[model samples]
Target: MIFPKILRLDKAILATGIMAVLTASAVGTAEPQLPALPQAVSSFGATVCDGYLYVYGGHAGKTHSYDTRSVLGSFHRLKLSAPERWEELPGGPIAQGLNLVSHKGKVYRVGGMQPRNAPGEAADNHSLAEAARFDPVKRQWEELPPLPAGRSSHDVVVARDLLVVVGGWQLRGRSHMPLWHESTLVADLKEQPWKWQAIPQPFRRRALAAAAIGQKVYVVGGLSPDGPEPRLDILDLARRQWSRGPDLPGKERAAFAPAACVLNGQLIVATNEGVLYRLLPEGKEWEKVGQASRKRQVARLLPWDEHAVLLLGGAGGGQNHDSLEIIPIPPRPEPTPEAR
Candidate 1:
C-alpha cells in the first residue's frame, strides 16, 4: 500500500507578500497569551466541557517513530482560566488515537487503537470499536454502545444532538498501510436506546479536521488515496447530505491532522505549517488570516470563547510539544473607501 505524499517547502510555491500582508493586518490587535501544557504529547484526544479542558490517550516521549510503547492512557484536566495548573483524572481503558467530543456537559471518548499484549509489538490489529462517556460532575466513566466497526484517526463532531463519526483509517496488513474509510456513522444522543446508524460519506480520507457551524459540519484537510485532500466538504444535518465547499489555499497537505473550529460565525482552520485561514458562512472561498504562534502537526483546537481558541499538544520538528497557544479571532476589518 502506498502512503499519501507529504508536502515540503521545496516542492511547493511560497505564499506571496500580498497574502502575508492580508494575514498580518488581520492579527494586528493584541490578544492574551496562552499557557503551555503540563507535558508534551501527540495523537491525543481533547475537548472542552463545563469550562474545563480535558485531554486523554496520546503518545509521549521521543521515539522518532510510531510505536505501541509510546502510546499512553493518561487522562488530564484543567480549568480554561488557569491552564497552567492541571489535575490528573482517572485514565481511560484504551490507548491513543481516540477522538473526544462534549455534549450536554459530558465528554465522550470515541473509537481508537490499542496495543496487543506483546512487548514492543505493533498495534495495527488492535483498532477498537468501544466507546465511553465521562460524567464530569461524578468523575466517572460510563460505557456506551460501541461502533459497528473499529476505526482510528477519525474526526468526531456533535451536530443536531447527534455524534457524527467521519472518515478514518483501519490497519490492513503487516505493513500497516492505512486503508482509508469513507463510511460515516451517526449516533442519536437523545434516542431511547443509544445505537449507531451507518450513513454515506461523500469521500474517503483520514486524519482530517472538522468543525460545526450552526446546522452544518465542515470537514477539511486529510490524507486521501491520491495524497493530501485539497477540497473542503460540508455536511448539512437537516438535509442529511454532503455538499462541496472551497479548496484549501497553497500546496500544503495540511497533514498530521490540522486543527479546525468555528469562531465568530466564521470557520478557522490551522494547518500543520502554523498558517491559519478564515471562511465566512456565506463566502465562496477561504481567506488567509495569519500564522499561529507555533508550527506543529496533529494539534487539537479548543474554542475558549467567541474571540479566542486554545491549541493543544502536537509534534513539530521530530519532537512532541507541551506548549499551548492562544489564537485570537478578531472581527474582519472593514474595507477601505478606496477599495470599496
Candidate 2:
C-alpha cells in the first residue's frame, strides 16, 4: 500500500470536497447527509442491500499493530433514506481482509483472516474458509459451504445467480508466509445445496476489487507478485472465458486495493489516487469521470442511488476513516444535434 503525495493530496481533497458540496447545492439535487460509521476501521467488509448499508469486521488497530482486540467482529447497518445511527446487529468472528456482497435481501460474508494470538504475542493470524449469510427476516446467520482453503484480502460479488470470490491469499500462520490464491471460486446462491467450484486464474493477487456488470465479473487492480498492477481481468460467466480489459489509469501503485461498483448499467472504479473512471459500455476502454473528494483505499464503493455513489470506510492520509463521501456521477453531455 504505497500512498504517495499524502500532504498535497489532503489539501487538494479538502478544497475539492467543499466545491462538490457547493456545486451539488447549486444544482438543486437533493443529497442526503451521509452518516459516519460508529468506529473507524480498515480492511473491513461492507455491502448495500435494500437501501441499507451493512458493515462488518475490520482492523481497528493501528497499521502494523495486530492483537486480539484489534480485529473486530462488530456488525452494523444504517438506513440510507434517513440519516441516523448505525444499528448494531449480530456479529460473527473477529475477521479482516474480506468483503461482503448482497443477494436478494440477504447479506453474505466470505473468507477472512483471524488472529489467534493475543497482544504482545507472536503473530498467529490464520485465514478462514467459512461462509455465511444473514437473513433479515430471521435476524440470524445461516452457515453455508466453506471454501476449499482459507482465503483473505479478497473481494466477492454476486453475478446473476452465482456468488464469485476474487483474488486473495491464504494466511497459514505466523511462521508461514501467506499463500496467494491462483484460482477463482464460484458458488450458486440459488442452488439447493451451495457448492463451491474452482477455476484456474492467470495470476495470484490480493487486495483487489470485483463487480459484475451483466454476466461478466470484472476483477480490478490490486497488489500482485510483481507489484501493484492495473490489469482488468474479465470473466464472462455466459461464455466461461477470461479476457483483459483496459488497465486502470496509472501504471504502478495506482490501484492497490481499489474499489469498484456498477452504476446506471455502467461500471465505475475508483483507484487509490482518487480518480474515478467509468468503463465504456463497449468494454474496450475507460474514461475518467470524476475524482474523489476523499482519496481512499480498501473502502467500499457503493451506488447510493441513481445519481451518485458513496465512498465509505477506507484508509487515507495514513489513517482509517469512518467518514462517508458522496461522489456524484457526472452526467454525460447531451449529444450534439448534428452528430445525432
Candidate 3:
C-alpha cells in the first residue's frame, strides 16, 4: 500500500521569500525611478553636519593665485529642505580650502594654506596647522591641538573615531615636497588630548583623497613633488601595510582635490576633470564611474545618509564653486543565510 505525501514550504524559506518580496516593494516605491545628474555647487570647502550644509574658507577665482595661497574665512550653511536661503554662522576659526570631517556631533577643519604676503607674489606660500572644532549644540568654536606639520593639499579622515591625516606636500622654494609622516593621529574628544600612532606609508605622496571603508583607508591619486602624474596607493589600517592600487585615469594635478566615498560596497573616486572611477575589492584596478559636471580642486566628499552623497566646492582651475552637487548612492546587496 502507498500513501500520498504532501510537502509544505519550510518556515525559514517562507520567511525569506516574504522578506524579499517586501524589500523589493519598499525599494520600488521609495527610490526615484531616475535621479537627475548632480551639478557642482560653486562653494568650496563645504561641510555637512546635523542635516545642514556648511561652506567655509575658500576664495573665488579672481582672488586665488597659482604661486601663492588663497583662503576665505566666511561660513555659510544651508538646509536641504530649504535650498534657497543660506544662513550665516558666526565666523571664527575659519579654514578655507581644507578638508572637514565630523565626529561626536562636532565638525573639525584641517589642512589648507593662506598667503602671508599680498596676492600675485608666488614667494610667500604657507600651509596652515590651526585645527578648529565647531560644537553645533553650543554654537561655539574651540581650538584643538594643532597638526605637527602644516599641510594644505593633504587628506584627513576619521576611522573608528580616530582622525588619520595622510600625505600632503609643503611649498618649498617654488616647488613642493612629497610628505609621508607615517604617523596616524587619534583625537580623543573625551580625553581632550591627541594620541599619535605610526602606520606604513603607501606612496609617500601628497594631495591625495582619503576614504575610510570599513577598517581600511584607501588613499587615491595625488601629485608628487617631481610631477603631477604618479601611481596610486592604499594603506591598510589593521596590519599597517601599504599596497599599490590603480593609477589615476588622467594627468596628475595637485591641489586639485579628489573626493572619495564608498558606494555599493565599492570605493568611488571622482577627480577634478569630472572623471568618476570605482575600485573593486579583490582587483587592484579602477574603472570609470561617471563624469563630473566640471573640474574642481580640493573638493570634499562625504556620505549623505544611506542613499546619497554630498559634494562640496573645490576650485575648478581658476573657478571656485558656490554650487552644490548631490549624487544618489547605490544600495549594496546582502548575503543569503546559507552563504553567511
Candidate 4:
C-alpha cells in the first residue's frame, strides 16, 4: 500500500495555527487540547461494551501468513477505569476475522471466514453465517440466528438499537464478489424473537467503516472494485434515505479497518495508518484530531468516564498487539452567560 507523503514542515506549521484558531473560536472560548494518545498493547478489531473494552480477532504470533491461517478467537476485556488489566471473556470454536459490534451490553460477532479444518477443503472455504453474541457479564457466548449470507471483511455498526451491516465479500478461488449488493441485514436486538430486516445499497462494498450521528449513519471509505477504496456514503435512519458525506481526506486503501465513536456529540474516526480525525456539522468535512504514536487499525474509541476516551486494539497487519491507549475527550466549552 502506498501512503501519501506527510505534509511539509512549513505547511504543517501553518495548518496548526489555522486549526488552533478555528477550533477554539468555533467550539466556544477556551482552547481545548486534544488528548494525548496513551500507551497501547498492539491488537485490533476490539469492541467496547458498557464500561469495558473487549478485544478479539486480528492476526496472532510472528508469522504474518499465520494470522489468516492460524488466528485465535480469544476475547479479552479491560476495565476503562481503575484496575487496567485484561480479563478473558470467552473463546469461540473457530477463529474469526475482524467484524464485531456491541448492543445493550452484549457483543455480536458477525460474519467472517475461518480456515477449513480438513485438507481437501480450500482455505477460502470458511464462510460463516453463524452469529455469536458474548454476554460480558456472564463471560459466555451464545449463538444467534445466522445471517442470510456467509461472508467476511464486512463492517457492522449499532445504531438506535439496530445492528446495521454493510459490505462483505465472498472468495471463489483467487477472485471474490460483492457481499453488499445481495442482501443487507438489520437486526433490532430489543425486539422479542429478534427480527432481521433486509436493506440494499446501490453498489457492493467490503472493508467499509461506519458510525452513527443522531439519525444519520455515515458509511466511510472501504475496499471496493478490488484496489484502494474511496467514497463515503450516509444513510439517514430517520428519513430512511441514503446520501453522501465528504470523501476521506487521505489516500485510498483497503484491508485497513476504521474505529468510530461519538465524542461530545461529534463523530470521531481513526484508521490503521495512525491518523485521527473528527467530523463536525460544517459541510461534513473531517478535521484531523491527532495521530497515534504507532500505526494501528480496527481500533475503537471508548468513553472513559465523561472526560476521556480509550483507543483499543492494534489491527491492520497480520499481528496481535496488546496495546491500550487513552485520550481525553475535552468537554465542550460553556457559553458565556448573558449579562443580567
Candidate 5:
C-alpha cells in the first residue's frame, strides 16, 4: 500500500510544535495519567463496557516476527471510574487481527489469526473462526457459534443484539495463499441457539474499521488488493442495503488500519497520521475535529465517556506502545444559516 510520505526534518519539527499546542488546548488542565497496557501490542481486540476497558489477544513481536511466545493470549481490563490499575482478566488463544465488542454487559471476541511456528521457523499461520463471549459476573468465556469459515483481520460490532463481523481475509498457512472475504457474517445473540448467517458485502478488504450508528454499520478504509482505499461503505440493517458514503478525510494512509468508534452519536475516526475526523450528521462529509498527541496505526478507539475516547495499544515511532491516550471530542461546527 502507498502510505503518506514521511515528513522531512523541518516539517517534522514544525508539526511536533503544533501537535503539542493542540494537545495542550484539548487537555485544558493537568490530569492524572491513566494506566498503560501490561505489554506493548497491536492488532488486538479491545472495547469498553459497563465502565470498564477490556483488551484481548494481540501481536507482541516485531513486524513479520511471530512465534509461540510472541503472539499473546493475555487479556486485561481497567475500571474506568477508579483508573488506578489494569486488572488481569481471563484470556483466550494466542491470536491477533480481530476486534472485541460489547453488548449489554458482556464482551465478545470473534475471528483472528494464529501462528503455529517457532520464532525462527517459516510462518505457519492459520485464520480462525472461533467465537466466544466473556461473562464478567462469572469471569469466564462462554462458547458461541463460530463463523462459517476461517477469517481474520476483520472487525465486529454489536447492534440490537446482532453480532456482526465484517472485512477480513482467510489465512491458509505458508504453503497456501490467503483469500479475501466478500461477505459479512452475522449472528443474533439473543437467539437460544446462535447460528451465523452470511450476507453479501459489496467490497473485499481487510484491516478495516467497523462502527454502528443506530441500525447502520459503517465500514471504513483498509488495504485492498488494489492497495490503500479511502472508500466508506454503509450497511443499513433495516433494509439490508449497502451504499457508498463519504470517503475518509485526509491522506489515504489514514485509510489503512484507521481507528474508529461511536461517541456522542457521532462516528469518530483517527488515522495513522494523527488526524482526527468525524462524520457530519448529513453524512455527506467528514469534518476535521481534532488530532491525537501520538499517531499510531490500528489502535483501539473506544468510548471513554460522553466527551472523550481511549486510544490504546498500537505501533508508533517504529515501536509498539503500551500507553493509552485520552482524546477529547470537539463539539460539532454550528450549521450556517442559508443566505436568503
Candidate 6:
C-alpha cells in the first residue's frame, strides 16, 4: 500500500540546548491519571454529550471472555466536572459491539451483535442492523432506520450534517469467519424517512477508528485482509473520493481498535500499544506525543476538552480492563533563547 510522505524534523535544530529544554519540559509535565470505570467493559461505545460522558452497551464482567452473557444493554453517564461519580441511565435496546455517535445533543446507537442463547455460544451469535436514538431528557429510545447490513466493530462519525458509518465485520457461513466490509453508509437525519445513502467503498477492514477532522472523515488502524493495516484512509466530503493519509509510525503494522478524536483542531489517535499520536492542521505527518498509562485494545478514546482526553474500557494483553485513564495533550513548548 502507498503511504503518505511524512515531513521529517530537521536534525540541525536538535542542538544540545534545545534538547535540554525538551527534556525538562517532558519531565516537568505531570502524567494524566485515569479513574476506574464503574464496571469492566469491552467492545463498548462512548461519546461526550451535554457535558457528560456517555458509555453504552458492551461486554461487561470480571472475566474477559467473549461469552454472550457478558453483553450488556445498560447505559451510564458521568459528569465531566465530577467524573468520579457515575449515574446509570435508562437501558438501551441492543447488546454489545454497537457503534455510538452523538449528534445535536442526542446519542444514536447503530448495529451490534448478541448471542441467541445462554452460554454465549458463537454458533448462536446474531448481528443486528437496528438503529435508535436516545433522548436524555425523555429517558427513552426512538428507533431510526436500520443499516443496509448488520455490522460490528465499525467506526461511526458525524460529518457534513450526516452520520457516516464506515467499515466493519459481519459473521458469515458455518465456520463463522469474520467477513470484513468495504461499504460506507451515510444517514441524513433531517428527512422524514431518514434517508440513507451508500457511498463508494474505501478499504476493507474491521475494528477501525474514525474521526472527522474537518470536511473530511479519517478512517484509521484496523485488521486488513493481509493483516493489521497501518495506513489511514481519508474521504474528502466535497470531492467524494478516497485518499491515503500518513501511515502510523511503528514497526507493528496496526494496533487493534485504536481510539481517535479531533481536539483543538488536531487529530489525536491512541493505539493499543499505548502510544499517542497527534496530527496538526494541514500537516502531512503524525507526531508521537506520549504513551498511554495502560496498553489497551478495543478501547474507546473520548475527547474531554482541548487539553484532556479519556481512554475508556477495553482489553489489554489478553485481559479485560475496567480502568479509565486521562491523557493530557499540552501545548508544544517553544525553544528557549539558550537554544539560539
Candidate with top lDDT is 2
Q: Give candidate 2's whole-model lDDT.
A: 0.86
- The models' CA-based lDDT, in order, is 0.75, 0.86, 0.60, 0.61, 0.85, 0.75
Q: How close to the true structure is residue 328 of candidate 3, measured as C-alpha lDDT?
A: 50
Per-candidate TM-scores read: 0.83, 0.89, 0.74, 0.75, 0.89, 0.83
Each candidate structure's count of clashing pairs? 0, 0, 14, 14, 0, 2
- The sequence of per-residue lDDT tens digits that candidate 3 reaches over residues 1-340 is 2222212667787787775566456445333232211222332355567777766665553634533334456666666655666777766532344667777677877766655655666546566777878887787878878877776667777766777777765543346653444454445455557755556564555656877765567777766655564366666666777777677677766324577876544677778787776664554666664556666766766555555566666666566565556555445454111112
| Residues 1-340, model 5: lDDT tens digits | 2234434447877687776676566667434589889899999999888888899989888976877788899899988778899899889899999999998899999989999999899989999988998999999999887888889999999867888999999998999999999998888888978888888999999989999877788899998988888999998887888999899977776799988988767888888888878888778899887678888887889876656777889887877889898877776543211100
Q: Would you give me the overall lDDT of model 1?
A: 0.75
lDDT of 6 by residue, 1-340 (tens): 2223222435555464465466446446444344577778888888988888888888775443444567788888887766667899887654676667898889988887765555644345566788888998998889888887778878889875788888887754335666666778887777777877877766888778898866678888888787887878988776778888888878555456788987665678998898999865445788887578888878888776656677889887666788887676766543111112
lDDT of 2 by residue, 151-247 (tens): 9999999987899998999999989988999989999888978889887888788989888876788899999888998999988876778889888
Cα RMSD for candidates in order: 10.0, 7.5, 10.3, 8.8, 7.6, 9.6
Which stretches of model 5 miss by more than 4 angstroms?
1-31, 333-340
On TM-score, the stronger of 1 and 5 is 5
lDDT of 4 by residue, 175-254 (tens): 45433445556888887667678766755776667766655677776666656555677776656667776777786662
User: Per-residue lDDT for 185 in model 6?
Assistant: 84
User: Among all windows of ten consecutive residues in candidate 5, which has the lowest summed lDDT?
Assistant: 331-340
**lDDT (C-alpha) at residue 49 in model 2:** 87
Error of 5 at 329 (Å): 1.5
